[model samples]
Target chain A: MFKATVNITLRDSILDPQGKATHHALQNLGLNQISKVRIGKLVELNIDADTEEEARSIAEDACTQLLANAVVEDYEITIHKKQTVS
Target chain B: MSTTFGIIVFPGSNCDHDAFYALDEVMGMETKFIWHKDTDLSGIDVIVIPGGFSYGDYLRSGAIARFSPIMNEVEKAANEGVPIIGICNGFQILLEANLLPGAMMHNQQLRFVCKNVFIRCETTDSIFTRGLNKDQVLDIPVSHGEGNYFISEDGLKELQDHDQIAFRYCDEHGELTPEANFNGSVDHIAGILNRKGNILGLMPHPERAVEPLLGSSDGRIFFESLLNRVVGA
Candidate 1:
């Protein structure tokens, strides 16, 4: 079994309305030190695959096809190999 | 000939019924309601991304909706040059889908604004407004928290150079007026058409003003224009 973590965020050029709203909320709560706020989604998956390469391919396909929107958002995948019990 | 148009319904979509009514009652077009979970896009000539707080406005306005199964079909239809319109929150979804340029940010004042405004038709060459005259003012209603459009200077120039800007706020005399520009949009832009001109995304709710009972019937022209195009083709 392989584990992967995916991070998704709006493209730098796109405006982030939610982030801006949150920033204002923070300031309203007296957290005025924050200059900028950008929000994103984090997803983790466990894949059963024969090899690390196979697991990575599956994860990438999921991100592109279903998980992340390549237009306004970008995603990164990090895979870790699981160790077996002796 | 009756043309079939599909209105996509996300979980929190609030404008699906309004869209359906406008197309069916006003334009006399066949309409279908497609769930966001469905991945099929067969037999639909026009697909509408209705306005609403999809996925409860989680992550972002249209972030989660962009991953719904129906978007895959919507994407395919857009590539085939099928007509598509996204209104209000639907406009945000199109940006998330990259069907249209630029993204919607919160109002400069950080408030949810709901009001009637005037929009000048910038181009009549698009499938959505083919018969309209340039610089014509149409009174429409806008209601959204995130309607401010942001684009880089180069991108803005590109849109201008290509005549992709479909609508801008204007006064009764068809003069560009900031009073009608509700969201502080760059260049007073209120709507835009894609490079192919078949896809359009606007922040106003034309569907909400199709009848005189709704206060103003000026929005009827939008549906009439699209209906005429579909019938003519």
Candidate 2:
């Protein structure tokens, strides 16, 4: 079994109001050195596959089909071996 | 000929009955509620994906609802030239389903904006806007948190070239201004049409404005236009 983590973020051209609001709050806390702030989503998945490549491919499909919307967002995926607890 | 309207009811759709009341009671037309799980859309002359928090608006608005079984039929029907209007949350679902281009983000103010806004009819070519003249302004109610529409520059140019823009957020005098853009949509876009012009996705709730008792009757034109297109055909 493999675990996949997808990090989805709004495209650079898209304006993120939520991130902007959070940035303002951070600035109020004296975090003035921060250059910019953007918000995104993290989606994790578990796939039963023969190989890590197969698991990654499955995760990619999920991102393209559902997890990530291509119009306003971009996504990155990472796969890791599922650690089973005895 | 008789025209039948179908309003798709997702799990959390709150505006399904509002659409029903506008179409069935006010307009005196046949309307039906189509459950999200149902795949059949045999007699629906027109489809209205009413506004509401479908699937609890989880993850993203209309994200989960787009995968509902009814969307398959909605897609097929759209391809066959059946007219479809997705209002507010329905508009988000249409975008998520890829029936219309672009996507919706949170409002510019980062809060749920509920008020009467003015939208200028940008084109009279589509079935939904045929009843109104070009540049006509309609006072419609919009209630949504994520109504900010976004599209790439190239995609927007394509829409401009194809006359696919159906409505633009405007002031009372039909002027496009920053203050009028409550949602901060690109080009102050309140609604848009698909390439074929059979599908319309808008952030405003036209059904809620169909009667004078509801604050404005300007939205009646949308239903009248669709009825004219289908029944008159």
Candidate 3:
């Protein structure tokens, strides 16, 4: 088994209402130094694969095909370890 | 044979019945309800993908549902020049399916919006709007949380050059103004057609306004117009 973490975010050119709202809220709370606040999702998964490379590919496929919509979003996957201990 | 309006029902599709009723009862046209799992679309002349939270709008609105088994046949039908209209969530699914370009984003307010909106008919080149004149304003209700439409700059230029835009939210007087743009859509676009013009995806719910009791019958005109083209042919 291999563990992976995926981060999904709106494309740079698109405006994120939620992220902008959050940024305003932060400013109200006195976090004025923050240049920007972009919101995104983090997905964690454990996959069963013989090799880490295979698990990474599977995770990427999930992101592109289902987990993330390529039209307005982008995704990145990172493998935690070579394999998970039973 | 009479024209058959096939309404595809996904697991969470709530507007299928409305669409069916609009086509069958109100317009007195032939209609059928199709299951999402069905792989064959042999007898259908027109396909309608109605709105609601398909796959619970999981992963993304219309992302998971786009991969449904029936979509393979849907794509085939679209390529064969079958008229397919996707409303609200159905529009999201069609975008995710890549049958239509661009994508939907969260409403500018980051909240679900449900209300009546006026849309300017941007084009009437397709069978769907032959009865309406260009820039004709139609009262349509759009209900969705993720209806903000976006497209690349080049894509918008191409859409304009090809006359693929079908509808754009506008003021009651048919003026394109910031106040009338409900969802912060690109150029206030509320709907568009594929390059071939057979496939249409829009954020408004035309089926909901098919009767005067629903506040307006402009939506009825949409269905009526399509039936006219099919029956005339």
Clashing residue pairs in candidate 1 are none
Distance from true location, Cα of B123 in model 2, Å: 0.7
> DockQ of each candidate's interface versus the true one?
0.21, 0.85, 0.79
Which 10 successive residues of model 1 chain B have the least lDDT summed?
B102-111
Error in Å for residue B129 of model 3: 1.3
Instruction: Please estimate how well model 1 matches the true structure, expressed as its whole-model Cα lDDT.
Output: 0.86
TM-score of each: 0.78, 0.97, 0.97
Interface RMS for model 1: 4.2
Candidate 2 lDDT by residue in tens digits, B1-233:
68899999999999999999999999999999999999999989999999999999998899999999999999999999999999999999999999999999999898899999999999999888787889999899999999999898999999999999999999999999899999889999999999999999999988999989999998798778767877887
> C-alpha displacement of B185 in model 3, angstroms?
0.2
Q: Model 3 captures what fraction of native contacts?
A: 0.75
Q: Candidate 2's residue-wise lDDT over A1-86, tens digit each?
A: 88888999999877888899999999999999997999999988878888889998999899889888898889999998765633
Local lDDT at A34 for model 2: 91
Give the distance in Å from residue B140's predicted Cα in candidate 1 to where it truly belongs.
0.6
TM-score of chain B of each: 0.97, 0.98, 0.98
